[model samples]
Target: MVVMWMVTGGAGYIGAHVVQAFLDEGMAVVVLDDLSSGHAEFVPEGVPLVRGSILDTPLVEAALREHGVDGVVHLAGFKYAGVSVQRPLHTYAQNVTGTAHLLEAMDAAGVRRIVFSSSAAVYGTPDVDLVTERTPTAPESPYGESKLIGEWLLRDAARATADDDAPLRHTSLRYFNVVGSGRPDLYDSSPHNLFPLVIEALLAGRTPRINGTDYPTPDGTCVRDYVHVADLARSHVVAARALEAGTSLEPVYNLGSGDGVSVREIMTTMADVTGIAFEPDVAPRRPGDPARIVASGELAARDLDWRMRHSLTEMARSAWEARRQA
Candidate 1:
């Protein structure tokens, strides 16, 4: 059975990898992106491209019906946590309003089965080190709150459309720090992500700035789970197949490496990967920065049969390679 997939923000870092994964598995893709934060070169050839916004209901609905889209991978939204705090209204408009528009379009077009890109921000700063899928959601910033709301929208949509007469089956994968590149041709440019920024600083012969040196962690810096984009991409594929097979039972999941690494560790790995002895400048902690936010994928594994397959070193190396090629 040939399944047509519609991917919003498919030209972005994570979305490009997901597009590649779907194509590799012999599935068709129709990418819808505005090229605001995403690059045109990242999208692969032969995939249908729609240049528009996810909030554009008529366009999204037309794409769904025209492409015979059976499933959708929703990746379009404002993702910068810091910026979201400064501009709460903007984040809500993009993440919340855009999601509502997408769901409405899907329902109108009679398309079922959606795999949504949620965030670890939903958990915010966890009280425990390894945050499980069962962790209580306490979002601190607008970005986190917006994504949490996105999850709620999916849940409500699924419940409303669960009847045989209705349409819409959905899975929301909440993840943290997605690093690495699936293809050098598809790397991010001037990204707000820490990994990309650090790499940029190193390549520019400047000292990378550390957020803080007074955190409770051993290195006095925050610890986070940095999963590879490829691994995350594979998880989306597994999710789609699971939904098709009636195997995925939950509408929400946490996708992470299940291990924590400090900011200093990432700097050290960047040096190791690039063979550059670069010094990092210690700076004050950024506002609203979480001390440590690591998540467990046990629930995802048990349900979608997913696992983290990439290491920290591999993650750094791939990003460094893409930087060099860029």
Candidate 2:
């Protein structure tokens, strides 16, 4: 039997990678994205791109049925944590309300399995050095709150629909700081991501500024786990395949490096990769930014074959090369 998956936000950076990963696994894919933060060119050649939003129930339902989708990879949402603070309504509308609509459509279409693109923001500020599955969720921003609520919706939907139909198998992958490019044409275009920000500055011959130089970390800047986009996408594929095979999996998993990379280290690698030499201007720390938070990926690795396969240098190099191509 052939498997087909509908990837919402499939034109966006992470979504594009996930689409490719599905193709690599010999599955058919259809993309439903409004192109709000996504580019049409980012979606691969063969896949059908349905230019629409998950908030549109009829459109989502049509896409699912038209594509004969067996599962969904939900990646469409408002993701900027800092901006989400100011735009709480929009955040909830996209992440929370949009998810509700997707669930409704999926139920209508009888598409059950889903692999959600959750975030590390669910754990606002960790009490422990290494974040684990047990880390209590206390989201600081509306974005984080929306993602946590998304998880709840998926769980409830699965539970409520289990007895009526085949069980609605689902899992959410949470990680921080997804960096590097799997393909040059599909680079991360977010204005707020560290790599894109720095690369944009370098491309324009401007020096990038570090947000804070006085954090409690060794370098006085923030430390976050940076996972290669390719590796992250691969795990999503593995999870989808597991669900298709009727293998049980945890409701959630963290795809992160056990250790993290510092902001200073990232800047150094940026310089090394781009051949730009200039000390970053230090700025005051942004409000509510954590000094360090990295998650443990043991659970994901044991089940889904998750691991950080790219070194920092390799991550930086691929990101820079892709930026130049863009």
Candidate 3:
């Protein structure tokens, strides 16, 4: 029997990669995206695509039944942290309410397995240098809060289903900074992410503006753990497949490179990758920006057998390749 996989926001960056992974495994797949931030062209041709919001419960339930979906990869959400501060309500609607609708649809459809594309922002600024899955969540922005709430909902649903004699199992991968592109046909055009913006500025023959140069790090710039999108997507597949095979029961996992690279280091790597001389302008730090955020995904590696194959330079090269092609 073909396992039907329903991927919410499957047309987006990481979602597209997961969809491709499932397709490669010979699974019947259905993609649901609202196209508000995701592009339709990014979705692979010939795959089932449902252009709708996750908040639409009726539509989601209908798609679940029509596609015979057995599992779900939930990646749909309002992801811009900076924008979330400006429009908290919108983030709550898209991330919180939309997630609720998806869960309700899943419960109704009898789909008991899900792999959530969670964020590292849920940990905020941790007390320790290397954050683990056990780190206390202290999300600073509405976006982070929304994601935390989504995790809570997943846990609640899992409990509710267990009480109803139909338990739901989920794996929420908390990704830090997701950079690099997996598909040559797709790339992020948004000016939100630092990696994309750096590439774009370099391509335009301009200096990418650095947010701050007064952080406490050695380089006086903020540091972050950046993970390749492809690796992150693969982890989702591992989590989903494991759940289907009755392998594990962990609800959350951290997915990261473990080594924190500073903004200056990333800039240097990007310059080397594109052969473009970057002269970044020093700008004031944005409000609510964390000084440093890195994750230790030891649990993920030990449990899922996952590894980071892409380096800093490799990530910059792939991203630059996609930017140049676009």
RMSD of each: 1.2, 0.9, 1.2
Q: Candidate 1: which stretches are off by over 4 Å? A: none
As a whole number from 0 to 100, the lDDT of residue 191 in candidate 2 is 94
Residue runs of model 3 more than 4 Å from their true location after superposition: none
Cα lDDT for residue 270, candidate 3: 84
Q: State candidate 3's TM-score.
A: 0.97
Reference-based lDDT, residue 71, model 2: 97
lDDT of each: 0.87, 0.91, 0.86
Tens digit of lDDT per residue, candidate 2, span 40-129? 999888889999989999989988998899999999999888788889999999999999999999999999999999999899888789
Evaluate model 1: give its TM-score.
0.97
What residue pairs are clashing in model 1? none
The alpha-carbon lDDT assigned to residue 212 of candidate 1 equals 90
Who wins the TM-score comparison?
A: 2
RMSD of 2: 0.9
